[model samples]
Structure formats: structure tokens, C-alpha cells
Target chain A: MSEKGIHIEEHRDDEASKLGMWLFIFTELLLFGGLFLVYSIYRWQYPVNFHEASLELSVTIGVINTIVLLFSSMTIAMALTAIQKNNKKLALRLIAVTLLMALIFLINKYFEWGHKFEHGLYPGSDLMALLERGHLLYFSLYFFMTGLHALHIIVGMILLIIAYFKVKKDSVNSDRFVFLENGALYWHLVDLIWIFLFPLMYLIT
Target chain B: MDHNKTHITEYKVLAKILLLLIFCTFLTISITSFNLAAFTVTIALLIAGVKGFLVLSYFMHLKYESLLLRILVGSIFLLFIIIVLITFIDYSFR
Candidate 1:
């Protein structure tokens, strides 16, 4: 037999990578799940306080943010489609659109939190300290869950920017785009958390 | 083995899903004006659940994923519900 050269095959498993992304998603879900559990128990205990506290949140802004996040989710999903179709420019543009929407969401959030601060509604304020137990729990969970959610948004934006650069460098291309795909999944998870949070915190009145 | 071509969701489909989600959002807000009493939160949550499902199946493309992944994701949600239910039961009887 003729001597054969050693063939070094580069390891690749997109499915495994995606599965890993989902497992991480499971953890994320559970983490938020714990918070949601806390929210339910407290809300049940202090239904009236939760109701009045939720009324303090502007439905107009919550509605706007919901639309913004849903729109961003669509754009990111469309970006995946664009990449698959070899339309790199369209994909990047869609990603840019998604990022813009994320910025808009944060801006709205900033104004919303600013409104709260103006009223001494923030945690650790003397006003908060004087609030009754149920009302206090409501604001604390509000700051905690929404703050955690905003932190996730920042992280997702960073991930998308990195994925954007990877795609720009052609390190993640049409044929191999799982990295970008996973980032989009994480973005969707952010949207998912807000979907629950919006009604629980804003519309439950 | 030849790798099958990945499914590419149509841009139009994604746009439609967004519209549907927006409609659902409006629907929730509209329902708020009504005095459904305790049913208000329940209805809002149901709509949110629907929105979550749409985002999961379409935006995240979980619908097209393999059965194993689907079952796994489904079970995780089930477990979350179970945990919440158990906690509620404990607190309710206490």
C-alpha cells in the first residue's frame, strides 16, 4: 500500500454549539424564573400594593418598549436569514437596526428610571425606607428584576457587537454562522424576560 | 455524510410575526381598560405567554429545531411551572 499523508481534520459541530447555547439559555431562564417566583409570592401577599405600585409605571412607555424589543427581535431574526442567503450587507444592516432598537430601549428605560428618581422612588432613598413593607418589596423587586434585565441587555449588545465584528472579518460567514446565531438567541432571551416583566410590573393593575 | 442545508426563515414571515406581536401587545393594553377584576392579570399573562411562544418558535427558530432540543426546551418550561406551583402550594397552605 502507498504511504498516505496524515489528514488533520478541523473539528466542527454546529449542532453541539447551538445545544450548548440552549443549555445556557436554560440556566438563564431558571435564574429569571427564581425572580419571577419571588414576584408572584410577594404580589400575592400584597396585591393592593403591587397594583398601586404598578400603576406608577407608565403604560405608554412600557408599551413603547415592548414594541421596540419586538421589532428588534424581528430584525435580529431577519439578520440570520440574510446571512444564510449570503446577503452579508443586509445582515449587518439588520444587526445595526437591532442594536439601534436596543439603544432606544435603554434610553426609554433611562427616562423611566429618571422619573422614578425625581420622585424619590429609588431603593435606598429615605422615601423608600419609609414605605410600607409591601410597597417597599414592590419597588425593590422592580429595581432588581428590571436592573438585572437591563444588565442583560448591555451584555447582549456587547455580544452582538462582537458577533458583528466576527461577521465583518468573515470569521463568521454564511456557511458557518452559529456564533451569530447564538448571539441572536441570547437577544431573544432578553425579549422573553421582558415579555413577562412588562405585564407583571406594568400592566397587572 | 452530507450536511443538510440549514433552514432560512423568510424575511416576510419575520415581519409578519412582529406585526402579530405588536397587535397582541395592543390587545393587552386595550384589555386593561376593562374591569376584569382578578381576570385582568390572568388575561395579560395569557397574552404574554402567547407572545413568548411566538418569539420562541419563530424568532428563535425553536420550531424547526430537532425533536430532542424541542423536548428539552419544553421540559425546562414545565419544570419552571412545577417549581412555581409547588412554592405557591407551600405558601398557600402555610
Candidate 2:
């Protein structure tokens, strides 16, 4: 079918693509897992400071964000189901809802971080430097872990956006939905990391 | 497209799973208010692990994946645990 009368094949192996996505997710898990290891060790060394620092965090906001993410995860999962059922309209609507949830979550995080900045609680700030080593480490890990997770949220949002467009264009449907599936997988991974982060950062005893 | 191989998870089941996750989250938060000391982290993590499993199996559809894929995923977690344990041993002695 080419200009030279030679046939060319389009590589569209869905299973292989999904496998690659899962492998990428494995690396992400390990990346965050290492940070978690560091957090556990430091918490062991300075339990009291970590506890006190954790108390300073707004549990109400943390809980709200957790609920938002859980709901968003459900919406994305539902979006996949919609597409599987060949309901493009419902799928697009669900994806839109998921995107809105992501925005709400980031907005809440912005305000939460803004409040901390107002109190001069950021890493390398004078207030943080004045604190003991344990408190310093606590805030440092807090920012690093949550910050990384937020970055993932942004990336996942982009993926969902692409999936949204693909679904609209008919490139991804019930028969060809690997793109959407992978995007949902990425979103779920984001939610999963937050599941652990909520406990470690917000529920410190 | 292997239509026969694809699994279409029901919406009701997904909703139920989400409800369970939310319940577990609340349970974790409430339990932390009590003074369980060292056991608090363990309990919180255990609940989180359950929630993670639910998301993986239901939301991510890992439950319907091939055995090779499942093993690949499982081995990653296993290796991570082994690494964590080895590190704990070193830290404990020091």
C-alpha cells in the first residue's frame, strides 16, 4: 500500500502496550517506596517531632482531599466502563468530571501549601531551620512526598485529557480502548499513592 | 481485539468498592485518634493496604489480567518488601 507498492503494517498490540504501562507503574511504585522507606526510618528516630508536626497539618483538608480523590478514582473507573459499553457521551462526561475533581484537589492543595507558606513552614525557611532535626525532617519529607504525588496528579490529568480527545475522535472505543484503560490505570495509581500518603502524613500517631 | 477476554466490571460493584474504601479511610482516621501507640501505624497501613488492593483489583482490573502480568506485579511488591526488610535489619543493628 506504500508508494513503492510495498505493504506496511501498523503496530497495534494492545496487550503489549498495557504490559509496558504496568511496568512503568512498577517503577513509579518503587520510586515512592524508597521515599517511604526514608520516612519510616526518620520517624523511628524522631517520633515525637513527627507527631507534633503532623498535628500541625489540617486534618479536615486532608480528609476532604482524600474523599475527592476517592470519588475521582470511581469516576475514572466508571468512565472506562462507559467506554466499554460503547457509550461515548457518558464516557466523556465521566472523564470531564474526573478532570474537574483533579482541579479541585489541586486547588485545595494550593491553599493548604499556601497556609504553610504563610506560617513560614517550608523547607529551607527560617522557621523550618529554627526547628529541631526531627521536625525539619518531617516537613522536608512531607513536602517531597506530597509534591511528587502532586506532580503525578498533573501528569495523570494530561493523560486523561488525551484519552478524552481520543475517545471523541473514535480512536478509542469499546473495541480499541487501550489508551483509555492505560490512562485510568495511571489515575488509579495516583489515587493509590494518595491512599498511603493520607495515613503516613496525616494520621501520624 | 479480544472481546471475549475483556472483562466489563459492573458499575454497582465499583460503587460498592468505593464505599468500602471510604469507610476504611474513616475507620483509619478514627482509630488514629485513640492512643494505640506503635500499633497505630501498623493498623493504618494494614487498612491502606486493603484499600490499595481494592483499587488495583477492581479499578485497575488487575484481577482479570494474565498470570504472567500478575506475577510481574506481585514480584515487584515482593522485592520491595525484601529490600525494606534488609534495610530494617541493618538499621536495627546500628
DockQ of each: 0.81, 0.85
Q: Indicate the worst ten consecutive residues by lDDT in candidate 1 chain B.
A: B1-10
List native contact recovery per candidate, as a fraction of 1.
Answer: 0.84, 0.85
Real interface contacts reproduced by model 2, as a fraction: 0.85
Q: Worst ten-residue run, lDDT, model 2 chain A?
A: A7-16
Cα error of candidate 2 at position A3, Å = 15
DockQ of 2: 0.85
Give the range where candidate 2 chain B is weakest over 10 consecutive residues by summed lDDT: B1-10
Runs in model 1 lying further than 4 Å from the true structure: A1-7, B1-4
Residue B85 error, candidate 1, Å: 1.0
Give the deviation of candidate 2 from the true structure as CA RMSD: 2.1
**Tens-digit lDDT track for model 1 on A121-141?**
898999999998989999999
